[model samples]
Target: MSQPLTGVKVLDFSTLLPGPLCSLLLAEAGAEVIKFERPGQGDEMRSYEPKVDDDSANFVLLNRGKLSVAIDLKSPEALSQLLPLIREADVLIEQFRPGVMDRLGLGYAALAEVNPRLVYCSITGFGQHGPRASEAAHDLNYVAASGMLSLTAGNDGAPVLPPALIADIAGGTYPAMINILLALRQRDQTGRGVHLDVAMADNLFTFQYWGLGNGALGDWPAPASGLVTGGTPRYQVYRTADGAFLAAAPLEDKFWDNFVALVGQDANALAKMSPHRAIEAVAAAIALHPVAYWEDRFAGQDVCTSRVVSLEEARHEPHFQARGLFDRSVTTAAGGTLPALPVPVDAAFRRPDRSAASPALGAHNQLLNR
Candidate 1:
């Protein structure tokens, strides 16, 4: 079957996680993604650690099946070099600071004049014209600014650092992809493209919808006091006897009943007790058994409980293996191959052969002269 975006062309002027990940998804959907990098250095992620084949594994993972074109966007003749690609591109994505593209003469206004049907997406820490638009921030800073960090408190009452780049991937990459796809559909009807200003911090408010709803009703709970945010014993992480953790989230009465029975608790008593005290009691019970014990005990039960496994364990999980989630592999520049990181695109839309590796810096420079 032909991929959905078989003929679409993408001009990617982004770096690191958010923009690269967004373009990765587009590439999986069969868009011809051409990553436009700097003259010598490419995406900063190319220099990140855990190298495979002398290039950063992080870069290869996110940039598989994409072409690379190197050009000094800061040069006097930069626009001339980029005009050909822009004129033929259906989408253009950039992650620069608010005014950087405008100053480079590659802003949406300039590029849209050349290809008015282009869907221009700008992914940033903040929106194009906000007070914090030009502020420098990483994933943690954006989550902090979005109030997501405040809600992830540890047992010591301090906010714990997130294990993943939630703000970058969720706030920026996912939103950029969604908006770009929507804009593309809109373009088919109107024959005109749209500009997407995706602000990572701004998009994070949706993750706090429950808190926002409470705040709107003037009944906002304190940090970590909501049901899903560790307020209730019924939906929280508990430490096991072996120091490993079990994520328990028996939110419904039926599941809570199963969990209470499995843990030797009185469901009625737990239901009536204060939430904090109940949490303590549940934690104590959970601590009586090791993680493996609970994992086996909850195997077929509908209690919504499971052992907290590391990434390595997760990669080898039976459920994920059955789903064939990690079946795709991308080759490296040095002929080594690694598992291609899974994106949300459907398998039917993805390229069947995943042998494509990330391109070398400016690997497609000949396209510029053409």
Candidate 2:
């Protein structure tokens, strides 16, 4: 749909998950996001597992609504094309190590000379001038470095690896998108460009605001012993009889009462018991029912509970479909259709456009420089 950010051009000089995701958010909001990749391989994700020739599943999810413009940055002729385009761009996003962009002479300073109003953003594992700015790390490593790993664990169990990339998405992708949007707003008023140095590792700390707040207020060993971690039974996950799970996070007294009242859980589980025992009680109560039974009971209730859904099952979930979450079309290479995620916008305000399918490497070379 042609929504807000319509006609806004984004020069995406980023690759992999976080960078691509940042551009995807802009595209979803109706920007012309042109993705620049290495000359041949394009995004490394294009060849990541779950492939069909060049269409890797990971690539499709991240690269949707984006046009691929492959160019060799090391080549002067290829790099020169950015001069004209950056002049026209409203925003430019890139994910690279600190000095890499500077070496290519395509860094924020270089581009600002040609396009003063360009919003240049760089997403990195560390920020542009940090001690670890040039350190090599992936999502897992970023989380570990940020101390997020230390806080993840069951009672006396091993530290658990989260199923998703929180640092990359929550830290890198989310912040970069927001920074660009903020920069865009500022550019509208100030008519000046800005540089955003976003670090995925830094995001891990930000995502732990609740925990960090608790640590600041309550002090040390008691931090995880406070509101969010394993502190209250009202905010925890419990496994059901049939091996499914439900999340219950009713923080306020009224809501917590509603949660435990439904399952007849011990009242002491709420205010006084040690965190471990409190969680155990909640788990015990939830373990008595099949997920379907609780799913029915929790249906119209405000207990802060929901069934933990799988990726595949979630794709077919009726609630999302009812809410029109997947409202766009994804055309397969042979022209078949799959539901593409529409995005967050009011139906009346969102403009409809036939979004062209994502391109192969160097697919839109002729149009890239414009």
Candidate lDDT values, in order: 0.90, 0.79
> Largest TM-score belongs to which candidate?
1
Relative to the true structure, candidate 2 reaches a TM of 0.90
User: For residues 1-370, could you state the per-residue lDDT of candidate 1 as single tens digits?
Assistant: 8899999999999999999999999999989999998878888898999998778999999999999999889899989988988888999999999999999999999888999999999999988996888998899999999888988877687998998999899999999999999999999999999899999999999988989999999977576589898889889889999999988899998999899999999988887898999999999999998888888999988999878889899999999999888888888767878889988998888987766788888888898998
Model 1 score (lDDT): 0.90
For model 2, what is the error of residue 176's alpha carbon versus the real structure, in angstroms, after optimal superposition?
A: 1.0
Estimate the TM-score of every prediction: 0.98, 0.90
